[model samples]
Target: MATVTTLAPQAPQAATRAALRTALRVGWFAAAVFWTVLAVREGVHHGWPAATAALLFALAPDLALFVGLSEAPRTARGQLPPRAVPYYNAAHRALVPLALLAVHALAPLTWPPVLAALCGWLAHISYDRAFGYGPRTKEGFQRG
Candidate 1:
């Protein structure tokens, strides 16, 4: 009797960077879905103005970050350098959450709007944390 020999499939090793990136992607996607659902629900129950306000405020930080990153310095190859630019970008991300928290503390916001903003901020934190992008992390923001 002849027996067939088969090679066992190998399990992929987890790389810290890749795992972090994947987590960030998943968190961002979840945040987007959550935002859409909250917006729709608020619009249906409350009104367009309230929903619009929530959506806009929730997205403000992300928009600001995008603009800031766009104008950030780049290397000769037209790519953001790994060290300075990335640190700057991470600082930019950290600022969004801090700004949101400040607004929440200083200004009075209705529960729905406040909740929406908080959720958005949490999403941003998750994205940053996943990619090792925060003040405490090695690759993230740091005090000078």
Candidate 2:
């Protein structure tokens, strides 16, 4: 029942924050392509096992925005409680994976699987951001 002051908070109520269904589908396809390319590249260099592990991190974070128990907010329509908006934004943020990358770069871990997973997160976020899907507003709408 919570709602943001705006359509998605970042824009006015009249803004076209909702993407058309067809556009959503196409955006998904683009995301898949983005994931595939990165996964493939990781597989080629690190082997399938690493790629497999990497896949674990791939869509999970982004998916977390939309997943909730019956009483929780539904991110699909950006209908989460106003207080929960920050959680969705955190899930959609690139800070964690980027931080991992920075740490890896500075520390140079020998673990390929960990690095691969980090890459997957980066790739997934990249895909979503690339196609205009971003953190949801409390009003259950995206700024697309």
lDDT of 2 by residue, 1-144 (tens): 997684446555335434454566576667657656766677678897778867877867755544444536334543665555676677667788778778887884567777778777767776777666778766646765
| Worst 10 contiguous positions by lDDT, candidate 2 | 66-75
The alpha-carbon lDDT assigned to residue 140 of candidate 1 equals: 27
Model 2, C-alpha of 129: deviation from truth (Å): 1.2
List clashing residue pairs in candidate 1: none
Instruction: Report the number of backbone clashes for model 1.
Output: 0
Candidate topping TM-score: 2
Candidate 1 residue 51 Cα shift, in angstroms, is 1.2
Please state the error at residue 42 of candidate 2 in Å: 2.4
**Candidate 2: deviation at residue 47, Å?**
2.3
Name the lDDT of candidate 2.
Answer: 0.68
Each model's lDDT comes to 0.52, 0.68
> What are the per-residue Cα lDDT tens digits for candidate 1 across 1-144?
999999765444446656766777677667656655655666556666656665665555444334335435543333333344444454446456557656766776555555454554455555544444444223323322
| Among all candidates shown, the one with the greatest lDDT | 2
